[model samples]
Target: MANAASGMAVHDDCKLKFLELKAKRTYRFIVFKIEEKQKQVIVEKLGEPTKSYEDFTASLPADECRYAVYDFDFVTEENCQKSRIFSLPGLPTLQE
Candidate 1:
C-alpha cells in the first residue's frame, strides 16, 4: 500500500524510506517518524509533521478509524526487516 498521497509519516533513512512497524498493540497509526540518532520513534495523529521531538505523542481519536485496514511494505538496509499490518481483536467488525 504505497500511498503517495497518504498523510502517513515516513522515515528519513534513504534505505528504510518508510516508518514500517508491527502493530503489536493493535494500534492504528496516522503518523510515525524515526530519529536514527536517538533511536527514538515518534507517533502522532494524522496531521502535518512539524514537531518530531522525543517527547512528542500522538493518539488516534476514538471516533476516528475505529475500524480500518493497514497495509505494509517491507524494507531493509543493514538489518533484516519484516513489516506487519493488523487490526485490534475483540472487534472483528473492524477487519480490513
Candidate 2:
C-alpha cells in the first residue's frame, strides 16, 4: 500500500501488519484536536469488541475528524502498546 500523504510505497508486510493490528484492535492512541484547540486528545483503546480504525473514522463527526488513522511509523518499537478502549468523558458506552 502507498503512504496516504507521501504517495510512497509502503511495504506489503507493513500493510498486512496494519490490517492485522486493526483486526486485533491493538493500535491505541487515537489522537484528535477540536476547533481552536491547540493540544490533541489521545484516546486510548480500552477493551475487547474494540472498534476498527475504519469504523471509528467513518463514525467520527465531520467537523472534528481530521486523521483517519494514527501514523505508527513515528512510534518506536519500544513504545508500541495497547490500552482498554473506554468511552470518552460524557459519552455513553456501547452497552448503554
Candidate 3:
C-alpha cells in the first residue's frame, strides 16, 4: 500500500504471491526488495519448495535491505504437524 509518509507502495503481484505461499504453500520462501526508482516494493526472488533455509539466506544481498517470508514446517514431539510463517524485515546484511 502506498502512503504519503513512505511514498512507496507494494506491487500487486507481491500480495498475490504471498497469498499463494500462505494459503497454498506454493513457495518455500519469498524475498522482497524496494525499488527506489519505481517507489514500490516488489518480489525479488521466489524459493522452490525443496529449497533450504540456508538457500534463502544466501539469496539476500550483502549490502541491501530486504523483506522476506519463510514457511517453516516441522513435526512436534507429540507427532503433530505444524507450520509457522516467518516474516523478516530489514534483515541484517553482511555489510552490517
Candidate 4:
C-alpha cells in the first residue's frame, strides 16, 4: 500500500514483520527506514526478543529519521501480565 501524502510505498516485508511482532511476538523491536532510492519504506533491522530497550535505542541513527515498533511487556499493579506495542516515528531529539 502507498501513502498518498508522501507518495511512498511500504515494502511487503515491512508489513509482514509488523504482523509477526504483534501476533507472534517474533521480535522485540523492528526498525524501518525510508529508502529514497526505492521510494518505499523498508525494514532495516530486527531486534531479538532478548534485546533490551537500550539496545533498541542504540540501533537508531543519530542524525537520520526512522520508524520503529517496540514490544513492551510489563506486570501490572495487580500482577497481571501485559504487553503493548509502541510505535516510534521520526527523529527523536533531546531537549536542552
Candidate 5:
C-alpha cells in the first residue's frame, strides 16, 4: 500500500509488492487505518518518494478471495522498515 510504501519506504524498492511471509505464501497490505478515520494511501512514484493519504473501506474483501489471515506485531513504520518480516528459510524463492 502507499501508506506502507511511503510510511516505511525504501529509496529504491517498488512501491507495491507481493511479499512472501513463507514458502507458497504471499500477501499484500493496503492502508487499513490512519489516525482518526479510515484512509487509503496514494504514492506519486515518479514525482516524489511518496505522498497523499486517503480513505478506504473498513471491511476487507473476503468475498474476492484476495486475502488471508496472519498475525502481525504492530510496530511503527520506521521500525518496520528496518526489520525483516520473515527469515531467509521462510522466504519465497520458488514461484509456484
Candidate 6:
C-alpha cells in the first residue's frame, strides 16, 4: 500500500502507527464549527506549540451534527497559504 504522507510503500497496519507518529510530532490544524442558525462558522488553530486537538474537538456540540475534519498535510504549503487568504471551502489553488 502507499503511505498517506509520502506515498511510498507501507504496510496496511502502519497507517494508524504513522498517524500516531505524526500526532506526536505536532502539526498545524484548523478546526471549524458551524452555527447554521446564526450563519456563522468559527475557525481556530490547534496542535502543538499552541493548542491541542482534544480541546478543539471538545468545543463542538456533543450531539450529532454536521462537521468536517480536514488533514492539512495533504496540501502544499503554498495552497495552505492561499486558503488562509481566501477562506475557500477546500484548499486553495495557486492561481487564486
Per-candidate TM-scores read: 0.22, 0.25, 0.86, 0.88, 0.19, 0.27
Q: Which stretches of candidate 4 lie over 4 Å from their true place?
A: 1-4, 90-96
**How do the residues 1-96 of candidate 2 rate in per-residue lDDT, one tens digit apiece?**
333233333333433433444566555423322222423223323222344556555556667443224423234578966443333332221112
- Write the residue-wise lDDT of candidate 3 on 1-96 in tens digits: 533345677777777888888889999999999889989888999999899999999999999989998989899999999988788864322111
Whole-model alpha-carbon lDDT for candidate 5: 0.26
Number of backbone clashes in candidate 5? 2
Which one wins by lDDT: 3 or 5? 3
Counting clashing residue pairs in each candidate, in order, gives 0, 7, 0, 0, 2, 0
> Whose lDDT is greatest here?
4
Q: How many backbone clashes can be found in candidate 1?
A: 0
Pairs that clash in candidate 3? none
lDDT of 1 by residue, 15-93 (tens): 1222332324232333443334544333333322333322123343444433222334357795766555543322131
Candidate 3, 96: how far from true, in Å?
Answer: 31
RMSD of each: 14.5, 15.4, 5.8, 6.1, 14.9, 16.7
Clashes of 6: 0
Candidate 4, residues 1-96, lDDT tens digits: the string is 545355887877887888899889999999999899989888999999999999999999999999899999999999999999888864221100
How would the candidate models be sorted by TM-score, starting from the highest?
Answer: 4, 3, 6, 2, 1, 5
- What are the per-residue Cα lDDT tens digits for candidate 5 across 1-96? 233433532211222332332322333222221232333322212111122121112233334322212223346867763222332122122112
Q: Per-residue error at 78 for model 1, in Å?
A: 11
Where is model 3 more than 4 Å wrong at Cα?
1-5, 90-96
RMSD of 6: 16.7
Which pairs of residues collide in model 5?
39-55, 40-54
- When 1 and 2 are scored with lDDT, the better candidate is 2
